[model samples]
Target: MIHLLMEAKKGRLRHEDEKTSENDTGFATVEESALGKSIGKMELTHDLITAQALVFFLAGFDTASTLLSFLTYELALNPDIQTKLQAEVDEAAKAGVSYEEILKMKYLDQVVSEALRKYPGGFILVRQCVKDYKIEAERDNEKDIIVEKDCLVTIPVSGIHRDPNYFPDPERFDPDRFSDENKEKIVSGSYMPFGSGPRNCIGSRFALLEAKVLIVSLMSRFDIVPVKRTTVPITLAKSVNLTVKDGFWLGFKNRNR
Candidate 1:
């Protein structure tokens, strides 16, 4: 990947004499965009540009794959939900599949939202304390815990998502939880599948679009079903990223058949 990026960078650099058509609004390559740019008085270099490209590639690829895997698993197990989602897909197909049409898919959005809630790519969020902070005891007899500056704090995102307080019967895969009416009732900070604040996932919009597009394309032609090898309750592997123990085993039945 690094070699390919370097070759692309060279090509872009050599194309200084190329003329674009009037209709073409050519975009700058990562290397071109960062070359000679100043940030905090530090000029960007080729190394930094390549590193950033690598980060974008890896982060987007792994997280999106994980999300799609979990989504298919859920669909295979929940045929009712799969049928409902496929109905939406069929309706959309009549008008043709496009970015604009995908955005207007309410049920599709709800289904994807529920999948993320169940299996968030990032199960934990970590942050460093810039200053001392105090947390008051929740119970009368409990002692307060003081977090010193420079301390690292980890938020259990998966735990919060599965907590019954925020989402009743959290383990169940129900897209209605994200329906227009019920979605509004969810508390802020209770759901952070893509983290929160300004430092949230940069490729969130792209990631969601990719998932929607893939799901639409997949469901339009085939039905996701469980085969003999499929696991009823998915066993997650112990790893930094969420993944099935033996990977996802799903059968795709052709809709036309």
Candidate 2:
């Protein structure tokens, strides 16, 4: 990169004259900051490109790692849930699950969904209000809530995910909450391990797919079991991202497959 800078200064840099259209910066929004949302046309500078690349690597790696840790922790604690998931994956594995097959694995889907609900990698979602918004008071004598233009809005994702009204016995590691019969009962705008709406995470499906595949592969070979090092009640890290502070330690006993 320093060499490129020197070459650019000397007007001898290769591809200096080459132009990439605004659409050419692939996946720039993958790790876009919630607070500093792109408002209008953006310049694709070298620094911007470098920063985004770093964000993609760091954000994707850490977030996925956290999700997997929570997933294993939850599974280890709940042997019943793990067994069900394993059974489902085992069934799917008989034919060597293709990308399409994994999606059709209902129990696996439920397990992953429940895991995200239990421990979403992103605890909060932030949105900038471009225009004034209002929420009418539900009861008389109560005033409506008003949000002015340019105000930043914060949504507590983890809290909503665990809300008793939305999810009964929210702390329970039951995947049935996401089952086909029960999933319809889930309120829209309530579940969002990945952010919802237009500006939501672009890689949400990809992340889910990756997790499903990996979990299936792991479960097919071994059982997720809790060990002495694993925390009884996992504590959230006090960092900007959602993670277990003590780290997610679990045992993997080989299955009798």
Candidate 3:
């Protein structure tokens, strides 16, 4: 995934270079300007291109790493859920499951949703203050919080997801918590695995679907058993964006051929 992002960045850079060169040549010839003037303009263009590429490259890498960590931890912890998911995949394969068929797997979807809720890949959701505003307190006992322009606000996603008030026994791995009926009870903005609003992760659906397909395909053919080395209490990697501390190590055996 990181490699893909790098390759994309390189491709973007190459395209930008081509465009810049063409523009510089065209402008210089049209205006009969000196080569030095064209070179100066090109240098500025190069800086802008470098900045854009760096931003996108970092963004892609961060997003990909977060997603991989989230999925990895869920699979490691939930063996029973994994088994059921494998069963679904086996059945689907025999019956020729399409993309549309995968979308209808309510249980699978619920599992993924619950995993994301419990271990939101990104711990913090940051927003910049656009205007001075007074944020009202929801609780009568608490005072209203004041906000100034250009201030950074962080929404603690991890705390919200694990809040006992919103989810009873939040530590338990229960997909049913996100069931159609129970879902209505979940507070808005409290369950944002992919951050909420217009600027939320745009590729969330694609990433999730890809993960499900990959897991389904692998599980259909193998029985993934926890080895002695597999950590019982998973730890989050402090350095990374996702919940991967020590890598998940499991033993896989062919499922009855």
Candidate number achieving the greatest TM-score relative to the actual structure: 1
Quote the positional error of residue 115 for candidate 2 in Å: 0.9
By lDDT, the best candidate is 1
**Model 3 lDDT tens row, 1-257:** 34444554455322222233321211001122233233321333455657665765576566645654555556657778777777777777776867766766666677767777777766688999889999898997999888999999999988998999998998888888877698878776678777766556545655566656666666777777768887877776776465556776777778884
Q: Model 2 over residues 1-257: C-alpha lDDT tens digits? A: 44554454455644433444432221111333444333443445678657756676677778778788888888888888888888888888888878867777778778778888888877888899989999999999899999999999999999999999999999999888877688889898788887765667756655777677788789989988888888889777688888767787888898997
Model 2 C-alpha lDDT versus the unseen true structure: 0.76
* Backbone clashes in model 2, listed as residue pairs: none
lDDT of 1 at 234: 80
In candidate 2, how many Å is residue 14 off?
A: 29
Per-candidate RMSD, Å? 7.8, 7.8, 12.2
Arrange candidates, best TM-score first.
1, 2, 3
Candidate 1 C-alpha lDDT tens digits along 154-243: 999899999999999999999999887898898888888888764566567668888989999999999999999998788888888999
Q: State each model's CA lDDT, in order.
A: 0.81, 0.76, 0.66
Ranking by lDDT: 1, 2, 3
In order of appearance, the predictions have TM-scores of 0.82, 0.80, 0.70
- Give the clash total for candidate 2: 0
Comparing 1 and 2 by TM-score, which wins?
1
